[model samples]
Target: MTAPRTLLDKLWAAHEILRREDGVSLLWVDRHLVHEGSHHGFAKLAARGLKVAEPDLTFAVVDHYAPTRDRAHITDPQIARMIDTLRTNAKAQGLRIYDLTDPEQGIVHVIGPEQGLTLPGLLVNCGDSHTSTHGAFGALAFGIGATEVAHVLATQTVWQRKPRAMRITVEGTLAPGVSAKDIALGWIAALGTDGAQGHAVEYAGSAIRGLSMEGRMTLCNLSIEGGARFGMIAPDQTTFEYLENRPNAPKGAAWEQACADWAALTSDPDATFEREVKFDARDIAPTVTWGTSPEQALPITARIPDPDTVTPAKADAARAALDYMGLTAGQALEGTPIDQVFIGSCTNGRIEDLRAAAAVLKGRKARVPGLISPGSAQVKAQAEAEGLDQIFTQAGLEWAASGCSMCVGMNGDLVGEGMRCASSTNRNFRGRQGRGARTHLMSPAMVAAAAVTGALTDVRPLMNGRAA
Candidate 1:
């Protein structure tokens, strides 16, 4: 009799090439995603005179340093140089690159699934932290450092230690006005930032299964914030349907075979994990981050916690975060003034996120400056076709080209110093958007509400016609 295996164990065993005495396993990488920042890795490869081992399996994009406003010419010299370097290196290596003009060009994470480059039971790697976003397809995807990127380029394999497995299950139906982003924020708030350290997390149960593919991506995208290298959901009919008709998806008999194989990718009934946690969907509400960290989240209706009331071990850090955010203890997070609103990022920049924001801003005008950048060129085109762009622009929002704009403040779309922004990006770390900038992370609809009211406002009221 054989022992039951968890999904993570099955995937790991299938990809393992060799086990070494140092407790590391060499695993095959099915896909590699690179961005403009990959210049460092390409430089290393050039220094060693090594060409990419499997160029066909690798893809590149000009997202990180690409300008969202002006597409003709990048004004910043340093950014232009990085983009040119990526283009030259990718062309020389015979790897497919999604240039600025490419209709497929967008954030690496966004384009991967849209193009069918991400599939179940495969290993994926990228040079950005949010690469875990691909795990929504039941793939073992995670971020790698620059050195590791060079290694993958030289030999489509990476050496890694096996991580412990943890399963997070959510049951019950989500209430109206609640979203996957809120579920993620609430979960991270319940579990500290280091809760899933050295582990691979698998999300399961009714609530997860009920979410759309975009919602699943949003949930898995935040796995890194919980200290997990990988986050996954077992592929099902929802996953297969999304991949159908995609540009690179398997065709004919190969598609049938692939679906059959993916059907068996789930964990055995008796499989066990090293850690398990459960949540009821009904208990979750629209959530927002008040302090510096993503884990410093609270339901929109709740008041901020006083440092004195927190655990003794967390008191000092809480106090410091509050001070840096310029917020006082026990104050309500609602009605806090905001200077900006950003509605794009790998975490929540999909077409669905844009539609949600548009629904809120349909008959309203923004009270603050808002920026709307779609996740991919395809997404941007779809929004325009649906007239979502017109709604945003008419609501006093700035509709820009697709890229990682205002997410990291690296590509000239930065929130000014000392300004507070209600953002749809994933992280809320201190100075993540800009030096001395305060970021309040929330869902796209919530960001729209904040833009309309120029303050941290609950999205439910706007959705129900209760707010101005």
Candidate 2:
């Protein structure tokens, strides 16, 4: 009899074409997602005089450098060139692209799932670290480097060493205002960065099963921040309902069959993992990054950690982070002033995130300047239809077009140097938003709370009487 298999084991076996003497597995690429940053791979392809092996299986998007404002006239020549470069390359290869003008245009991670290009049991790859975002759909997904991108482009396959399996299970019910972002930050804080290194993580249990697809995506999107190779959640009704009728999703009868296949994609009851961790959902709260790393997070009510309280390695990192962020040891995280706020990114730029922010900012005015970029053009349109745009504008925030905006700092929408920003985007690494820009990562609602108060504030108070 065969031993029970984990979801990771099943996924790896399904896509692995062959194993080499060095123990590297050749994986068949099911979907290759490329953004403006893929120029290096395209350049390599050009220099090698090669064409994309399977253009139909590859998708290109104009993000990262896509402008969030004044699309008709991009002021930055470099940004304009980046967009054009991606467009030119996509056209040259006959690959479908979500261009700036495309209604479906958005962050590659955002649009891939929305358009149904990301499916259960498929292998997805992107040049960006957040390619793990696709794993939320129960697919095997991971980020590839520039060389791997070129390899996939030329041969429709990638060489990789199989990663170990890890399971992170969260049980119990989440408190109000506690989101998947909070759950993610809580786990990273407990385990520290690199906790899941060399492993593909599977999030399971009650709380995970209860999350919306958007929340699942947010959770998986931040997996890389904890040094996970990727993260996944088994496909269930929530997953199926979200994929139903999506443009690229299977049609009618095929959809039923696909769902059936997806239903069997979960890890078996007796499946074993290399490592396991469990958390009670009730323990998680509205959490935020107090320092430069995602693992440097704490509940909003907590104080900044003192370097002396942690291990030598963590103490060193904490000291450096505190110095860079201009915070004192044991300082209260709440009430720390913020210069600006941003609410958008592949991590939290979905419609649900927008609605969460708007719910808090509806009748309130932001004390600091901020920008709200939707995850996709469709999301922007939907927000407008729902009057969420007016709520944001009235609350003294700029409502911009969809793209990877302030999150990347590569696009024109950048946080000014030396500014402190309350951001909903994933990653608070030094210079992630801009050089010397101090970023405090939090949920969209928390960012909204900070925007309204002009400080790092807990979102629960603001959510008390609001309709979510």
How high is the CA lDDT of each candidate model?
A: 0.92, 0.94
TM-score of 1: 0.98
Tell how far residue 241 is off in model 2, in angstroms: 0.3
Clashes of each: 0, 0
What TM-score does structure 2 among the candidates reach? 0.99
Question: By summed lDDT, which 10 consecutive residues of candidate 1 come out lowest?
Answer: 459-468
What would the per-residue lDDT of candidate 1 be over residues 74-162, giving only the tens digit for each residue? 78898888889999999999999999999998889999999999999899999998888899999999999999999999999999999
Off by over 4 Å in 2: none
Q: Which stretches of candidate 1 lie over 4 Å from their true place?
A: 465-468
